[model samples]
Target chain A: MFVWIILIPILIQYTLTSVVPMLISFFLTFTDWNLVGTWNNVGLDNWKRLFSDRAVWDSLKVSVIYALYSVIPTVVIGLLLALAVNTRKKGTAFFKSAWFFPVITSVVVVASIWKWMFTAEADGIINQVLGLFGIEPQFFFGTRLALITVALLGIYQSVGTAMVYYYAGLKGIDTNLHEAAKVDGCTGAQVFFHITLPLLRPTMAYVLITLTSGALKVFDSVYTLYNQTGGPQNAANTLVMHVYRTGFFNMQMGYASTIAYLLFAIIMIISVIQYRITNRDVE
Target chain B: MKKRILNFFFYVICILLCVIFLFPFVVMLFGSLDGETKYAVTLTSWFPTQFSLKQYQSVLSVGGRMSRWVLNSVIISVIPTITGVFLDALLGYIFAKKRFPGRQLIFWYFMAAIMVPYQATIVSNYLLYSWLGWINTYWAFLIPGMWTVLYMFMMRQNIAAIPDALLEAARIDGAGEWRTFLQIVLPVSKPGLSTVAIFSFMNNWNNFMGPLIFTTSEKMYNLVVGLSSLNQQSASFNMQMTAGVITFIPMFLVYMAFQKYFVDGITVGSVKG
Candidate 1:
């Protein structure tokens, strides 16, 4: 039957793409193997090195920082923009479209514009804007500012996603709840806090989970901006970029898989913790 | 009076954010046009003193390879969009309507794959592809994403919503499963197909790391990766901006054409179900 066709393609694709690689990744994490050459079984060596490696720790620190700095604002701004644009007022469509423009556009393009903006030159937008306020040109891609600057660019691309989710959450809320709150003499702020916020918990959890994982997996922003050099002094070097570099560029495939598994572990832990936090109240 | 003021405040804040949201795009377009000199000092003006198509010309230049890059992007994105949509829908239909041995297990496998970072698979996939002699080929892009977990999940949800009665009616009318699926289910799942198409297209079109890692040569570069490489080599700032605009245009057009599906798909498929 044609059911075989459907099942066969999917199974074959998944096996090649995910299953084989994942099993290989697990094996690779134990043995040190460069792509072309034979490898030695360095049992627990990659795992042990992960504990002691300063670069791994530094990249983890950067990943955590990037994850936090990017996710919090994205969720907050998304909620705010959703609340703001989720209205029946004139030109609300325009506002919604404008906010969502970044989401639909390629992240590479956004990063390109931002890279141009963050140029250390006097003509760069950030420098120009700063100059307007009587400040000198700032080398935004430098160590001190590079990570946060990239996160800001990400927030621009991300806020739209948050807004969409929050907007959907807002739409799904019963209008009667709002009217009931109003009738109960609740102020707008009070109503939002008491009802809308609580009701949007599921959406919030989903947004934060996706956003946090996204922040952890960030490659494009830093990749585009720094020309894949991991930004100044490796400040913006993220977990995924670390994995890419170690595996591909440095050809340390085994160690890279170790890092990859560590990242997966981190993601799993964060998801589990957030899952519990967001779900506990329902219990 | 207070309500009026509050509403006005909302307008102010919302509009301000929208402008902020759109500002980079404005710069990517207007700024691209404004100062496209060999050593373009773009800060000189917000608008071009002399309106020139020079930057756009260079991006589309024979030497620049922008046109080739664009062609690569279109071929890569469009093929996958057409092929992947069908693949996802077919597999998704099975997942949705049929119950079989290890069906639950297979679906769970896909779900788990979606959670693992793409970076995790790079080492092994690269080795596998290289072993398959697919490196520096479009098959590197075309084959890997023949079916993605996300698209499959979305398609499953979409196909699941089609009424059982509809399928039974078609079946009772002597329609084969394939005929029923093609005749009835496909028609009903336009929204799902479109959503998958846009996402797959966009993901392919905007993809950077894939082209970066897989294709080792300049000639095989997609729009994003080519522009990114050219970004450093670009003679001037305006050239980069112009290239950005060109890269942005296709996705923008696709989005505008299917704005309803794109937006609704987001709210429906992406948001927590």
Candidate 2:
């Protein structure tokens, strides 16, 4: 009875939050409903519109660019940071925490700071610094450069997670493997490439997949920098922002849900591709 | 001599990196002191030419019900995290020790869900919340995040590391599953639980989109949303910085105080699986 009493609230909480929302999403995908009005079955219309919508395609393309931009470099930087810290002269703990500082800081804080940094005016610090080199002040958020800049910030913020995972993986490897390689006259770089890299595959796989998904769904950074307009002229528009605009700004919850589903499908297809590629060697 | 030189260079590099890491704190501190500092260039200003605590004063005073926002965030985040610890532990224990039919399959199901990006479910989730009339309530912010599947999986891995003989002896002594879990598992899994708790709390604290989608009213907003609204309402450099500092403080305090446990918490889950 006591356990049941405790479980009821949790169960109710989960049902209300997770279970119900998932089921409703599935239902809403096949319907034409806005938030304020009645939802009716419009089977395949939303799905069809999803296929033909140029904005959807463009937004998803932006999402892919954003995801790849963040995911790849994040993994590389994370690996380098882990490898750097793993050398362990001293103060590894301090360095580890510092690297993770941005992770805990709200995206709002980071985006706010970066927004100021990328401000287009000559007063913008980035431009001011570049002026010393005689380069004209560039509009970072107004061009494709804006999207890439946002992706770079995403990398900075999220690299800590990849670093932590990689560090953990590094620690788990038997020290003897390095010793054995050293005995065989292998250099440090050689050992890292041949031995450490292969051993860390599982961790790499985990980090890569998670980072990919996170990059795909990234909205807050771009939203904040662009003030939720997807940057100037929708140049930085991503799928999530598209859904957000469709639902909230355009008052087309049905269309937004459709965009959301398209995003879901793309993510799913990419995940499947990643699994196949990452797991092929395992079997 | 060569090795010593290499070590010196390494420390130099590490110290420089540390300064880069600490730059934001420097920016926040100095920016907080200046009443008129706005724009990125102001950060480059060495000292506050005109110092005033009015930013801090007003932030503490009529800061759009921020204190209430913090209180609400705490209630929503802390309650769910506490309850989630128990739920995840219970589920983890079952996965680690118990012999139920389809246990592995069920465990795998949860593990697979970890890979499914939250985007896959966001629309569905919103619709469900709309149907349940949960939109704009604290429950909306708290519910989806509570009882994370990854934490449960991580806890199960940590529990699995404990020797099976310990649990077998408890079982032989005729203790019930729940009792053995309380006595044997909970005590040993303290470090693991703390790690999960800190990670979950941080996730909930910094989450912007969850509240953005969920909370319709300003009164119900968490600090993240409140600060964003503050930015929109006023471009006043001092006020924005003050709000930024207010938002950054709790997390900075937590990170500084519990740095070790937090790092361990993050690395443990990652390393184990």
Candidate 3:
């Protein structure tokens, strides 16, 4: 009785907030209604429109590219950083904290700082570095480089989180395996590839799935960096950004829900694929 | 000799990566200190040649909006953190320890909620909140986010580790569920509670989208949204850096203070669970 009394309210709140909204979102996909207007049953119209939507496809392409750019580097570099810091040598704590600092920092601040650094002017820090190599000033956010630049910012912020996860994964590995491999005349690289890499599969699955989903839903950095316009020519507009623009800015609720559901489906499919590939040996 | 050489190279590489990671923060800090004259010049140095708090002074001055945003951030973050910790702890305790009808059904229902991406539900959430007259109000952030399934899951895992004997003993002493929760469970689960609190606080403090969408008035903006708006307004780099630094300081301090909890939370969240 007491348990029910306590749990009932939270469950009610949860249903109202999460479950109801989700059901409503599903229902919205079958109907068309701007916030202030009457609902019209559109049935499969939004879904059909999704197929021919050039902007939707463009944003999907941008999101996939962003995810590829961000997720791969985040995983690889994060693992390297984890390996370095996992040496457990003296002074490694400082390095761990230093590397993990950005994970705690807000995305808006990170975008702001990186946007400043990637300023297109010759005097911008990155452009200045380029100039030292006798390269011309590059327009980072102004050109096709915009998506990559935003993706790099995503990588910068998330690499710390990935590093922490990989570090934990590294810590979980049995040191005896490494020593045994070493005694068998296995090289460091060989031990890592043959033993450590395989053992870290579960962690890889977790990291890959989470990072991929996060990357696909990438919005905060791009929104901030591009000033909510999704960059010049919508170059950096991610799927979530497209949803936000459609639903909020354009006031097309039904179409926005359709795009959002499609994104959800994509994430679910990709996460399952990643889980299967990474966990092939585990089961 | 080969091992020593390899170790030396590893250190070199690690040091270089650390510099790469830390450079932007250094830039943000030093950039915030530059006076108007020095900021207008071509970037010749990473460090400010002339150091001044002119930007910070302007950003945080009485006439500025940064302070309001800071307050909004605090209200938005602190309320959710406190409420989330308490409610999640209670609910986690219920799910973990209590024997009740429909427990598995309710728990799985909450678990299933996690599969639905927040983006998918956001459109309806917007419509629902607006219908409830919550737009431009703190209620939008506070209500929907007061308790999360993820935090509840964490708390459930944490609270489950409490030996059943201990809880049984508490009940044997004639303590009610609420008393047992307030007295025994919470004290034993301090580490878990703190971990949840820190994460909750961090997520709320740094949340950009909720505040951005919910709050139309400039005064209602949290620091993250406020800073983004300032950037969108094409504020000077120095000014924007100052805002960035201001926004970052609280989380930095929190991380510094609870550094252990942060690492433990990450490992516990990923590696173990």
Candidate 4:
């Protein structure tokens, strides 16, 4: 009874905040509301509009491309870094801290620094370095390179997290298997491929799902990097960014909810697919 | 000889990667110290020829809103973290140890709710908060974020590891349920509580999207949103970097202070799967 009394307030709050909002969002998908004034039950108009929306498709494409550019490198570099620093060697702690520093830093600050460094001018640090090698200054934030540059920033921020996950996975692996493999005349490369890689499957799945979702939902760095716009010509507009822009900027609350549902569906489908693929490999 | 060469090559790669990760902060620190004149040069140097605290002084001055944003951020982050962690710990204890009707169903409901992304419900949350007249108030952040199901799940995992013998022993000692929880469960679960607290603090402090959408007035803005607006308004690189440093220093200090908890939390959270 006491427990019930204590749990009531928390549960009510949760239901009101999370459950009610979720239900409202679903209802919102079926209505035509502009955030102010009255709302009407449009009933599938927003759904139909979503299918024919070019901007939605373009933003989805940009998000997918950005995910590819960010996720693969993050996983790969993170795993490599884990393997390098997993040993109890001298100065490894410093290396770990250095690598993980950006992970803890706020995205605003990280984006600010990157924006300054990649300023796309003669004075920009990156462009200065390029000039030293006699290459012309490149417009990094321009439409041609904005998505890729933003993806690089994503990788830089998150690779540390991926590394930490991989490190934990590496620690969880039984050492006896490695010793037995070594005694059976397995080389370093062979032991890693035949034993270590397979054992890290679960960690790989978690990392992939989190990183992919994170990459897909990325907004802060891009929002900051492009000065509140979605890059030059909407080159780096993500699905979440689209939702924000449509709902807040244009006040198309109903349509934005529809797009938000679309994002949820994409994330769920991809996560289920990734889970199935990884779990099957494990078995 | 072959092994020596391989080890040296490995060390080289590791050092190179560290430098890649740490180089940007070095540039940021130097850039923040450059005087306005040096910062404005067409071909600005990477290293400051002469250091100046003008940017920092301006950002931290009493008239500026940066300090207000910082205070707002602290209030926003600290209050939620405290309340959220406490409620998460309590509910986690109940869910883990107590038996009641529809517990599994309720637990799974919360679990499934985690799948719905914030964007999915943010529009409605915005509408609801606006309806309640909390659009530009601190309540916009504090109420919704006061307790997260995700950390509740983490605390459940933490609390489940406690020995039943300990609880039974407490019962035999005639201690009430609250007493057992206050004395035994919370202390034994210090790691879990601290992990949730640190993570909540970090998330609340660095949160950009929630504050961006919720707060309309500049005064209600947290540091991240404030700095972003500052970024848009200011063209000076030194000022921008200075603001970046100011926003970053708190989180950096938190990370430094609780490095162990961060690592342990990640490891423990990942292992449940």
DockQ of each: 0.58, 0.47, 0.62, 0.61
Candidate 2 residue spans exceeding 4 A from truth: A1-15, A269-283, B1-12, B37-40, B62-64, B100-112, B163-178, B261-273
| CA lDDT, candidate 4, residue B79 | 96
What is model 3's native contact fraction? Answer: 0.69
Residue B153 lDDT in candidate 2: 78
Off by over 4 Å in 1: A134-137, A270-283, B38-43, B62-64, B268-273
Question: How many residue pairs clash in all the candidates, one count each?
Answer: 0, 2, 0, 0
lDDT against the true structure, per candidate, is 0.82, 0.77, 0.86, 0.86
TM-score of 2: 0.89
- Per-residue lDDT, model 1, residue A256, is 94
Candidate 2 chain B least-lDDT 10 residues: B38-47
lDDT, candidate 3, A126-190, per-residue tens:
88878999999999988669998988888888888888898888887889999999999999899
lDDT of 4 by residue, B182-201 (tens): 99999999988999999999
i-RMSD per candidate, Å: 2.7, 3.3, 2.4, 2.6
For candidate 1, the docking band is medium
